[model samples]
Target: MEGSAVRHFTPFWFSVEPVDTLAVRGAPALLNCSAHSDTPARVDWKKDGTFLNLASDDRRQLLPDGSLLITSVVHSKHNKPDEGVYQCEASIESLGTISSRTARLTVADGDGGSPGGWLRAVPLAIGRAPALHLCTPASVEGSHAVERWLFSH
Candidate 1:
């Protein structure tokens, strides 16, 4: 043994994934992304701008060199006319192609409650100062009705 010592390696980041906004319309939603290679890779998918050709369409499966499998995501009826923008592009040619920052599938314009649908819940499902009726001794207007805050809880 002639003293064996060797330590020199560098790698801050080689893989990073986080692009799949949200979707919920006709069910069936799976939009995941992953990338980062060294020797094996072949993930390339696109949408919105259009460029997603899974050979034809056998489920668009591929989970070896990371992920990016989005199959069956039908959501486009709110306002119609093509609806909002939905994009997802990811390529891998030896650490190249990185276009994934647009994921938005919002199709909410039917079952939101009923009759005007609560105005479509502002700020993402009700946020404009909800919950009313308060009391503190300054209760001199309807005597703080509504069963005292619905039985105090």
Candidate 2:
């Protein structure tokens, strides 16, 4: 066995974990997740501690890079399906599964009682000078457009 090449297997690990995100109702949202390992890994997702079946859900898509994409955020007084805590799980046949940090998705209602309206402002603090946080949609197409503004009064 002289001059034989030895292969070192790297343990599976998450390189990019999903982060908390806020999406306007009827807009798309994405939860990023990336993993690395010596063996090919399969990716799955969980919502509210329950396994999410992306195959049955038409509005949801699992990207090739292990990211979950919501075609449209669904939120209403009667039904809010897209807003929940989510986690990404990666697994290999020979290795145990590894889970990423939990990320929460929040759906915000549109202003003026509209569903697709993209302008909203939240007051962070109220004092002699109030701080306002505003999120507006950008003019980009096919991309998640979010513009934030901080105003100190």
Candidate 3:
């Protein structure tokens, strides 16, 4: 076995998976996805169980890092296009393909009302000084991350 060389192979896997996100109407949204493999893997996206063609849609862009960026979310009473379940797929030649967890993109109105309703804040007294901290009001159901993103935009 002297001077012999051996090669190890690594299969395709997702390092960063997309998560459920709440996007505001007419605001930018991002679905994070990252994959790795011994060979170069091409990343694609699926929306509502159908293959998404990023080129056909001008509003959608696939970032260099494999993340999908939606320039503007479209949602209305009669027409809703961006609200659906999404999944990222990574594939390498001769290695087949692997899919990430399904993440849902919910579109909310731009009126500051989320699926979780309005966010409330309460004053906490700390040694005679009151500090305002964000607290989920009753009937609120969503992550702080989503809430922060919603308000930030």
Candidate 4:
């Protein structure tokens, strides 16, 4: 994309799919974000409009491929300033900044010990629908191409 340079320039950005939202409390989660481009830029992890400290002693880590890992995350932590919305903003030099679809992290009822906890989730279900990813994750993540099956319904 080429154009005249005005006072400021905004780059053509990328897009994230309709996110598969999760509702859980006191459990670790990883928000998977995969990019189609390799342009070096900054990716921000934000919770409730503020910068999330990914380097804290908490197991939360910012994966290099653009995913967020929330270790031992509690639902109580998400209900206030941290409990609202989480967004992944990617900024590229030529492409400016774009964000992932905001994920509404909610508190789930009951403990996460249900036998169905490991069942097919609402968004991705192998039994209900044959799953096919339009774009697959890169070859970096160890289990990128592997798909597991569960027959006990």
Candidate 5:
């Protein structure tokens, strides 16, 4: 049996590069920050200027490859606040620290389709001739009341 020799690490340094990613409203997004080094380094991600707190938010998760994964993206002021500059940093005990370029996270604005929003739901019709139903109260007393449908071209 042959014995394997343990490899030692040197002062090798690599750049941390994070690419800008686009995400649609109400969808998932992933921001990747990958790097390489002779010695393993600690990776940390920051948003806008503050360090990300992965423990507080359940929708945010830190992947094993030093990437940030967003569960759902909501383009609203009170909802998800994920639109901002993102940066990745890598540091080693023996080696030096390196930070990646600032990547902007843009969340696409979605058309507001709330119940009382401006965009109302369209009535769906299957055939050419549509049917219209008018409901009236039965407790009406009238001598000669006639209802007629008027059509205008």
Candidate 6:
């Protein structure tokens, strides 16, 4: 062969894979949001639709696997807004942006051993498929990516 050509391309996509997390009140908690991408991507954590300030807070830290970890879960009589829905947003140049599944963080009043408590309050679902959100650019300029929701039951 006189001349041969070989080409390689990186797949631009974002994937957040983390199951629902449960934590006891007044204990340590870890909110996971691991993202995978063929290229570099920015991962941001959000709680209750508000962006979490991981850089300024000492209690909050972004793990090496792109997951957010809360040092100590706080639940008091005065304020207990820390327990809520948490999600992670990952964005890439070619992949656009994608939001992870909403994870409900329920703080139990005790060690989760009492009957009819937080454990029992939560419902269990069978034969549920995982969700994946994706945003692909149309022209990379002045274009909005259309979203398509896919579900299997």
Identify the leading candidate in terms of lDDT.
2
lDDT scores in order: 0.41, 0.77, 0.73, 0.54, 0.62, 0.61
Model 1 C-alpha lDDT versus the unseen true structure: 0.41
Output the lDDT of residue 71, model 6.
70
Which pairs of residues have clashing backbones in candidate 5?
none
**For model 3, which pairs clash?**
none
The C-alpha TM-scores of every prediction are 0.26, 0.70, 0.70, 0.54, 0.60, 0.61
Model 3, runs deviating above 4 Å: 1-8, 112-153
lDDT of 1 at 83: 30
Residue 52 lDDT in candidate 4: 87
Under the 3 Å rule for N, CA and C atoms, how many clashes does model 3 have? 0
TM-score, candidate number 2: 0.70
Per-residue alpha-carbon lDDT of candidate 3 for residues 1-153, written as tens digits (9 for 90 to 100): 789866567677998888887666777778888898878889999999998999899999998778898987888998888999999999887778999999998776755464445422222333322122222345345744423312221
Model 5 gets an lDDT of: 0.62
Write out the backbone clash pairs for model 4: 78-83, 79-83
Model 2, span 1-153: residue lDDT tens: 799977666688998888887766776777889899877899999999999999999999999989998987788999999999999999987668999999988777855343333434343445322232354444454676655565543
Which residue pairs in candidate 6 collide? none
For model 4, the stretches where C-alpha displacement exceeds 4 angstroms are: 1-20, 77-82, 112-153
Give the per-residue lDDT digits (tens) of candidate 6, residues 64-142: 7677777766776677856888888887865578788888776656543444222212122433222322233342544
CA lDDT for candidate 3:
0.73
- Residue 80 in model 5: lDDT: 51
